[model samples]
Target chain A: MDRSAIIEQLTEIMIDVFDLDDLEYRDDLSAADVEEWDSLSNIRFMVAVEKAFGFRLSNSEIESLDNVGEMVDLIQQKLA
Target chain B: MTDVLTLPWLLPAPADFRARVRALKSAETVKAADVTTLAAYGLDLSQLGSLGKIVDARREELRAEGRLRPVLLGVAATHTVDLVAEALPATALRHGLLVDTVQTDYGQLAQAVLDPSSSLAAAKPDFVLLALDAASLGLARPQFEAAAAHEAVQSALDYVASLRDGVRTNIGAGVVLHTLATPAESLFGSYDARVPGSVRWLIARFNQRLTEEVVGDSDLLLDVAALAETVGLARWHDPLRWHDAKIPCALDAVPLYADHVARLLASARGLARKCLVLDLDNTLWGGIIGDDGVDGIKLGQGSAKGEAHLAVQSLALDLRRRGVILAVCSKNEEAAALIPFREHDEMVLKEDHISVFVANWTDKATNLKAIAQALNIGTDALVFLDDNPAERERVRQELPEVAVPEVGDEPSDYVRLLSLAGYFEAVAFNDEDRKRADMYQANAQRASALQKVGNLDEYLASLDMECTIAPFDDLGRARIAQLINKSNQFNLTTRRYTEADVAAIQSDPNKFTMQVRLVDRFGDNGMISVVIFDRGLDSWHCDTWLMSCRVLGRRVEEAVLDHVAAAAKAAGATRLTGEYIPTPKNVLVEKHFEKLGFVQTCERDGGGTTWALELADYAAPALPMDIRTTIAFAA
Candidate 1:
């Protein structure tokens, strides 16, 4: 997946998952930006992303995917 | 049977909200069988006058009852907004409320919300329903950016944030703002896109923005979207193409929408807090082991009913995954209870997932309390689910705080009933939740070690009782407060405090306080006890001393006694003394000090016993205890 496309997909997922009305994806945007991105939902988000991208995430991979930039990077690696 | 307290809808509420609330009142039936019928209409403003009249009637009826206090009171304001404002003073005087509407002045609204007279302050409706007009946010084909309207929205948002903090501080007050941002669909033109006009579109936009702004702040948002969906689905599902006139009244849809609103409210409260205290018998699976034999008991994937039971177990396991602690409170022969837990392959929640397992024939409430004490949570957090209603009712009456969901007579709806309760919703997950069961299991192992200790002092010392006492740190504060709330027998002075309270104590230099985490070869007993003190002008007074009952009789008490004695001696105090206030329970420890060699200092008339131990003569017993120490010096 193109990094931008992956970012777009992740943004859409975040919006849907958090029920954000009009979410604008920024590199600094993280789980902290959204209230509904609770610990349980975070795990669910990871599960959903894994299914969507067709790749399993390790503990390190999940931990490292904290910020939007890191998420985009991981997505690029998976797609590559 | 009419819930005269509920605000009558603008459209005549279909006869159903009354019927549904009535059913809830009566034990005759469960939640409405077909709530789909209730979900069929939009908020019809034409009936606003009628709704006002009905509300007046209901308020009068409640006033007549004298005892009926409305959890939430609803009022409709017509074009006469000033009259509505004027009525608030008298309304607050009589019914105790100021209206919760979209404010013309955010400051005034905040003051009103903070004031004791505000409806938000008095009634504390979990959410304030605000009726807004469409023009406020510019409803169009493309949604306008909320940031553009930030100036006006910011004031409301800030006021809301202020109210949020205020509500937390005050009792019977936690006001959440819910905006109904729309006029009427028919008046707004084809703005509805599918339904009718801008009203519907405005409602959707407002709901969307309001939801965003509220974020984690609001308990729940009552949106008109679900009701619109219900109406749309109803219109489409109708076989005969009917005109608007032939369609059901929007009022008829009120009950359905109301129920959806109620469920949403319940969900927002965030899952019925329920530590699942399960009974092991035919309850978890099938068969009475003493009678049917272990192998004969129905279980496994092959048996359909067994599968259903296993499905229930699996649901419980899933609930545990979501942070619900699964505990076993069964009245069975201990060996029989263990058969399935230890031997059965299909058991989803293994022995370890059970945070507290009491297989003895003890009264379940006692066992349940033991579990709550062990877990260091309130009994109210427990939801006792058993196939037997008798068992359920027993616990319900004894531990009334525990939410006992009524499991139906039929086997099939067991899973369905459990799901409806939603007893396992968690805001966050933690390592503590996952390891809770293992901790309890380890405590059980620690219990077995207690049996081997030769004498009280020897046992306390032999297991190498290590006390990790430090000034109450952030990590241990929650567990400490939890100990205060849950600890009973070993608790000298049950001084219940919250996390904030503990932090306040830590900042105060006059008070000497520390929590002790007892650990041994068996396992880690996390924050097992706490003690506090005040060095009085004449003497050093031991304020509070509490240890976990699980770690009691293991010379944990010896550590506490020794610590307090040494502290008193070090302070150059003449004597050390403590007080014990009697409750229905804690009678077990009424004679605790007499056993510990404390002399009676003063005995008040019909109050509780008080004791004092002289620092000069107090000899710290040289017990055969394998002990480690971590005590802090007085500041």
Candidate 2:
């Protein structure tokens, strides 16, 4: 529910959806940094996150998120 | 056969599912068998997508290794079909098909069908799916005037008919059309049905008209509106996702949608399950029939629990009425199992309804195999429904091909779970389908009588069978097509044909077609055999020879061969040629031509053999049945 916890959970989701060995969480890490993080997998990642956090990201919210930091910040805001 | 892998009935959470996927990925070499086993479990949308990627990769590898040939499915949709396409292969695995999909560009369905150079045309798929939704087809637009709404419906249907004709004439591929799922939100709420211009009313009318058009045709229809109604329409249509990504339905419901499509495709391939093998005790009735006597069993209309058990019986009876064969497999004493079916007043399934009943102290896996053998169907065609998880797990472990739904403890949930599994999905229904269960029951009766007679000759003679052999006509065309697709065992060539194909054959001047029906003192076995022969100057080639296995060991083949040889000889043919094509299910007829006195003439690659019988020296075999024919043939 906290920022660090949200970051950790988001990292796990990305690792699974992207089929990565491990991910180094950074403020600017985005789809451009991963080959497998395409549009389809991005949708999968959003679905997984919503199922995990028990909150839905609006269509616009899902489209506008820029990076890992932005997604973590959005989760923090939704939780608040 | 390899060992059956145990899997969970319920789908796991995302984390656990990912863990399992990771383990599969870490294997030294991913096997298609392992992937198929994993796919047998219930999967959600995310898991379906993930597993579909694995299936696609494995499909390529298998194709490259010369071990797999997939059915090419061409998809054309007005919305984004990427997710549905991705989930299709995984869902298709459950129905015994390796599907490789080629999708047309978004909103290019018309162009793809019209243009010869499009990728969809180039793919030359076995089946083309026109996945149109209400919004994409303009059916979602409401018109205040009834004339405008009717015109809109007419135009939409006309456009679809054009596409269907184009697909058939240009690509020569089967077309799969879908009904539009009407929008959930209505403008006038409960009064929407009163307004012919309302979106709901217009779409419903369109769906009814669509069903009327496609019902007797050779093409397949996926009832998307009915599917949406099954799961709440509100859950089926995701407006947010549709507006954002053009997703046709909710992402979570994609697996279910793909499953329905897969089942329809499987039915066309003659792979739909035919029998429902149910357990006694907790499955059919509430209390253990053995421990609780016939009077103590909770069934019928007394208590809620009693009615719940009765509902299960009612469902089984209904399935039987629609031509699905029913069998009972239990571990209790045979007498105890029969008491409820015979003595209980509230029982919906009676002793006469079941074709094969096995009650012994054997393990369920072995008993299920026996049931399949007794019914003359493959183990894969059996759907085992039991209330005990342990028994379900054992059957899953032993006979992985048999469908075992993770039916929870509640008897009330059994019908819903089994219904949603779509194990008995059918594409066509005829009078023959309604009487199929009765025919199987008659076969069971003949089996019991054979045991009493003690001699094959005496048994055959005592039954006093009579058959009417005639040329294929319009009246028997539907049943002929159904038998051609449904008969896997005792089928010489295992060739599948649609009703349209059969109709074309019927009118061909150079071909001879026969539809054989047998009836004895027991019951009428309605059109049990279909044969087609190609006429030649000196030889008549048997293009297809298939008989229902329920009539096996009764010298039906011998009688048919006698009639065919006489008919061919009478028609100025000097010889008869037959071919045996081997398939996993058709081994029952591997030596068919040889047994019928045809000498092996040539051996083909891939275990196929050709045989020829000299009609100049053909001797009619002694047949038990009194055969009558519309065609003139020397007896």
Candidate 3:
């Protein structure tokens, strides 16, 4: 449940939700960068992330996240 | 069939659905059968969305290759229906349907139905689904007065009626209506039932009124309120999701919703299963009946385990009451299997309830096929229930078409799982459905009588069969249409007709239609056969010749042919032509024309053959049944 561990698990979920081959973890990585990541898929991605991290995300928390770094930070804060 | 025991049952849906999807995607060509097998292990919204992508691609490939023609389903909903549409194709695959859905834009259900030039009308779907919610129809709002509430319900129903009539006149599609699910939020808590204008009261009234209005029609009703109540209203409705995405139900419940819709559609298309094949030991009752004596077996009112088994028997009996054929395919000795049915006082399913009973040491897969054969139904029309996982797995491997639900070790779970499977989903029920069990039981009596008599002709003579034949009239139209759709094994040219089509044929002067009913000493077999003959230049062409498989070996077809030939001769036809069209289930009638002295004139490429019988050379076969006819024929 450390930052890198969360990032690693988060990358696996993104890969599954977006059906991507590979993804590099970075703060700049966002929905616009992935072609398959749309509004509908974002809902699925959020659900998968919540399930994987064992935490629920509020509607505002889900909407406010802008990048992989923000999502990782939210997960870390929620876990804390 | 014996080797099925060596093969493993289908693996349960993997814990990691994404991994399974990846594995399926990695294959060179993902087969429809593999996708269907995966779909059979129900999925959640995310899993359904993932699997639906594969189903869509596979459907396109099959349609492009001329291997599939999907049923077009136009979905119009008050909320966003993308998720339901996404889940449909994969869920439909479980019911042997490739559904191509055209979804109307969010909150445009009324516009889609009213506008003649809309995409829903242009696509001309086989079924138009009106997926409405209580909130969308304004039934969720509490009216201050009871009269206002009544007016609200009436207006909502009137609006729905307009939409249904629009779909029928504009698109010519069958309408699928949804019952409004009462919102979880209640104004007065338990006291909501007392208020006429309460959300719960209004929604319940609307649902009841909708159900009453569509009872005797072809409109398919998806009881979403009942479904929501089953899953708990709190779990079924999500306020956050509704506010954000405009989704009708919770995302997790979309798969079940899609499955119910698919079952209704499948039932409408005559794909609902007909029989429930059951195993005895640890299934109907507790403990092995053979090992434990009748008095020793744990089955009656004493213990919790015994009552659980009794519940299973009660469910089977209820299904039989609804015309679903009950059959027994067990591995125990015949006498041991019969002991519980005959001597046990606690048994709910008696010997008379089961249509076909096969108890032997043979493997279940082989015995299941025999049961299907005895019932004259396709193996696909059977749902096998057994407590043993190994036997269930073996049957699943041997007969992939037979539905084998994964009932865990709990006997109580069997009823829930089978009920949720929707295997015996039905759209219509008539008098024939009520008497179906009795008809099949009488068939079993005739079979046992044949064995005792030791001669077929002597058995037929002892039965004292009487045939009442008449032209197709209004009274027998419904049964005639049902027989046309259901009879496959003993059907020549396997042509299906609707009741409307049968009515049209009844009035056509150039066409001759016969509805045949047979009765013997055992019991009355109601309207067992239908024959339609079309007059050609010098011959009477048999457009449809089908008989109930129960009356097959009794030479009912021969007697019907005798009457047909005599009628054709009186109608100034020189020859009678019949065709044998081969379908996967209709192989039993391949040589029907040839055996009836009709010369094979041509054999089509797909194993279909055309035969002709010259009227001058045709001789009526000696029939045991006393023929009674209302139509005139050659003396």
* Candidate 1 per-residue lDDT over residues B1-635, each given as its tens digit: 11211222111345444333233333332211111112211112112222222334345443433221223422211111322322222222111121222332332444444566654456544344332323323432333444444334444455445555554454233333445423322443564445422345445545665667663432335455544453454432221111211222232243333333333433333223547888777678877766776678888788787887888788888877765678888888878788887887777768878877788988999998998877666675687878787887787568755766566455556676565434453323445456555566676666666677646656555566566666666776656655665465566766655444677787777777778776676667667778888777557777788776656666666666777667667766778778786653466778887888888888756578888877787788765444454545555
DockQ for every model, please.
0.01, 0.49, 0.44
Q: Write the per-residue lDDT of candidate 3 for residues B1-635, one digit (tens) a residue.
A: 11111111223456877777877776677766677777766565666667878877667664543222257899888888887897888778778778889988777787888899998899978889988777768887899798999999998998888898888778777788888877888899999999998988998889998899753355778889988887778888878788888887776677778888988887776778999999999999988988987877889798988999999999999999988999999989999999999999999999989888899999999998988888778888899999898998898889987999778788877787778778888877888889888888888888889899998889899999999889898888878877886676788887766555677899898888889999899888889999999877689999999998778888888888888888888777899998998775678999999888999999877679999999899878788889899766412
Error of 3 at B107 (Å): 4.5
- lDDT at B447 for candidate 3? 83
Candidate 2 chain B worst ten-residue window by lDDT: B1-10
Looking at model 2, what is the TM-score of chain A? 0.95
TM-score of each: 0.54, 0.93, 0.89
* lDDT digits (tens) for residues B374-419 of candidate 2: 8889999999999888998898789888999887788877777777
Q: Which stretches of candidate 2 lie over 4 Å from their true place?
A: A19-25, B1-32, B60-70, B115-117, B632-635
For candidate 2, the docking band is acceptable
Q: Write the residue-wise lDDT of candidate 1 on A1-80 in tens digits.
A: 68788888887667544534457889887888887676545654665576578887776777777687788788898889
- Candidate 1, residue B287: lDDT: 71
Deviation in Å, model 3, residue B182 alpha carbon: 1.2
